[model samples]
Target: MSYATALKRAARHNPAWKAASVFKVAVEESGAAVLDASGEFQYDLAEDTYALRDFTQEERFTLHQPYDGDAALTVITANDPNSDHLILWEGQFHKILEVLGADALRGTVRYRVKALPQDEAVPIRHSIIL
Candidate 1:
């Protein structure tokens, strides 16, 4: 079997080896205001929700690191030029501050990512009880 194919299979099944994943990305092109049903004008961000939806495999890099105080908090897509890519999770948004890549050896690439602070926020259920 080919090494590249084997590596791809591993990355797909190994959760420990994967880092930040781009699930949904969005970007607004016009940045125009729209009228709501209540007759109020509101800025539309619906188009800005999938900016990175087209990320290619070569552009995806993630390094899963243990929870350490010194781990990096920012992640960048190495091959993408867009500087405003955002990571959407649990109804919150995390903006990608920079672009970065993973080191590859013999057709395998690995990279790291820092989790967004929003993911650490107390759960709504716990907050409601308190």
Candidate 2:
């Protein structure tokens, strides 16, 4: 099997990875933002600094991506997350800042995201207001 395929399989079967949902934000006529579920995916979330150092040499070499100090990194599989998307994880909202890296073989996508501000993260019946 290709390295990309193997990597995806490992991430899928790994118990450490968490399941999450992806959402797209839409603005209403009243100028209020609402989150709509777009897709589902699995990810391994970690502090950017720790993840950078913890990643294997092959993984780092494959990514060739850099990140900001305040950003958190999430190694994701299954769904492609856009920069404008928001992720509902651990009962909180995280805004995707940018895609750090994408495997050339389409195995995974690494994203840099930050927890949304309290006011912007207000959830009403599972939908968030941006």
| Candidate topping TM-score | 2
* Stretch of 10 with least lDDT, candidate 2: 45-54
lDDT of 1: 0.33
Compose the digit string of candidate 2's lDDT tens values, residues 61-122: 22565543335555544445468656665555677776877767665667767777657633
Candidate 2, lDDT over the whole model? 0.51
Clashes of each: 14, 0
lDDT of 1 by residue, 1-130 (tens): 5554455455456543333333222213575434445644322122111121212343433478543421222222223333333343334544444444333433422222333566443211111111
Worst 10 residues of 1 by lDDT: 121-130
Candidate 2 all-Cα RMSD? 9.9
lDDT of 2 at 50: 9
